[model samples]
Target: MDATKMAAVGLSASYGRGPAITDINLEFGPNSATAIIGPSGCGKSTFIRCLNRMHETAPRATVTGKVFLDGEDIYEQDPTAVRRRIGMVFQRPNPFATMTIFDNVAAALRFNGRHSREETDKIVYESLQAAALWEEVKDHLFAGATSLSGGQQQRLCIARALAAQPEVLLMDEPCSALDPISTAKVEDLIFTLKRTYTVIIVTHNMQQAARVADRTAFFYLGKLIEVNDTKEIFERPKEKLTEGYVSGRFG
Candidate 1:
């Protein structure tokens, strides 16, 4: 599949009364990974939620400015279509407890539209493989999704997103609840997945950002402080705020 480019122009979002992120401008290239990092409540999650219109789902939530997918304004498109094209995995691994692994992966495609059982199965298999969870679960596709370990469950969520065939994938702190081993596995998966999908991840782990992202963006108090190649952002940040935060001086 061809990769997609995403651009944010003067983008801002607010929940009810106050702004979470303001006047954010950034561009993400196709087939690459960009990590958004900051302290808690820094609006990194809110910024990614706006990329696919997920922010609007919150009651009284509002957004200003524009987010573009391949030069087209995302806000001008159908929300459902936008979501289908730009998929998200949350901070927690949330596989439906009632559904089997196969069904969990197939749910996205089935919800989008009708598909032959054969086609659904094919996609389910491919997505699991893409997520690096197939070999572990192929023999028990019918097993409940929650029966798997946390790491496996998170990969299942990733597979669910892949089943949508999204051009861009947004992950909001996907490793926060995972163990070191599980986190490493997901980090490896991120490296592989970026070969086809444009990946934007929100993470608090700066070392993880350095490991997975080609570029890094730092946000603080809802404002973008700096953006650059991961090495430069960590090794030679231009902004004192960024340097201080990265050096453990302050959040």
Candidate 2:
């Protein structure tokens, strides 16, 4: 879990022939929190999606450049296997409406080829505990996932991702839809989770980035403007664009 262990090389992505982001080179150290901050449509979300190959799910989306997972090229191998090692959580809680809480967490394991009931159960419990949802729903594992509060549902979504025991976790504006209290809880959870999983988050909230990220990368007009330690990015940015945005001059 050393913060300097994992790194990513040059990465670029586009939709059809139109480039959304380009010349993006960065590294996400193991067990560290890296935040991508930008205004809406600045390609922060697109960047994270490309990390796990979810960009391919969008029609006409195409990605180029290499994404190295512990020095191996993820883009050169089977995307499914890459995704098994890098999980994602979206802006909204997207638990399957028809499945129960326990089943939602277990589905990823089952799909990844864990067929034993005992193994699935163990993974489900461990994932839920990791996501900080086990104490609330351990007795109601069969309850519909949607029945939980917005905060709980978001945590369940996180649990579902963790069930696969991924080495990296990608979160896209994960607290955007929640109340302040719920957002605080998710923020706290992100801090706790970074001890075991390298986390890359795309967030519009500058304060959130300043609060949680060890390192911060700023995006402007689909290009990376600056990347440095969070404190420097917030307090003494090297780029005028970064200072302007952080100082509320412009996005």
Candidate 3:
């Protein structure tokens, strides 16, 4: 197995004193893919956000326990710096409608103090290519990002995340808004991406999780019920709850 890139030790989180998830422990390996799978409202998204310190963005949201990146406590460090190294992509394509595609991809690099225009341009193009969007949008770099299709917009958001060159990428249902074909494209991208960056995705689609993840974790009512290799989780789950959920008996 690859070295651990991220780990949660007894992680617990809540909204306004109401616990959303508790005692969650998991480790994500470098250059590997892990998927958090469960029904809606199972705290899967909350868990991923906690990994990158984004859980604090919500009013009244609080997190306890430890999140370690390369064995360093992330919460003890600067949240801004943690986010820069652990990028995220949301369920919808959140491109800035007012900005052009090029600007959208360049925003993070600029914010992080990449001042040279030549370097910014090079990073933007390279990141887009890494996200598999460059060939399609290369000629329209300055077009309004919103002018693209939903699939293209999602890919653009991915490119924007990649621009930061994060060591770990946390995605919350990244392909939820895309069509089947677009979802397939993103799935392929995720598979290929594990060769370069660790990926943890929260997905409700069982087939999607099975298709792209090396490991799958099942959460229920704020508790992780089981976690194991994808084949074991889907084909021969160890726990009754895991088997029921994966076999479509119940969510």
**Top model number, TM-score:** 3
- Per-residue lDDT tens digits for candidate 1, residues 58-161, read 99999999999989999999999999999999999999999999999999888889999999999999999999999999999998999999999999999999
Task: Quote each prediction's TM-score.
Answer: 0.97, 0.96, 0.98
Tens-digit lDDT string for candidate 3 (47-136) = 999999999999999999999999999999999999999989999999989999999999998888746989998999899998899999
- Model 2, 38-141: lDDT tens digits are 88899999888988889978989888888888788888889999999998999998999999999899988877784688888888999999899999998999
By lDDT: ranked, best first: 1, 3, 2
TM-score of 3: 0.98
Which RMSD does model 1 reach against the true structure?
Answer: 1.9
The backbone clash count of each candidate, in order, is 0, 0, 0
- Root-mean-square deviation per candidate: 1.9, 1.5, 0.9
Give the Å error, residue 45, model 3. 0.4
Better of 1 and 3 by lDDT: 1
Evaluated at residue 231, the lDDT of candidate 1 is 95
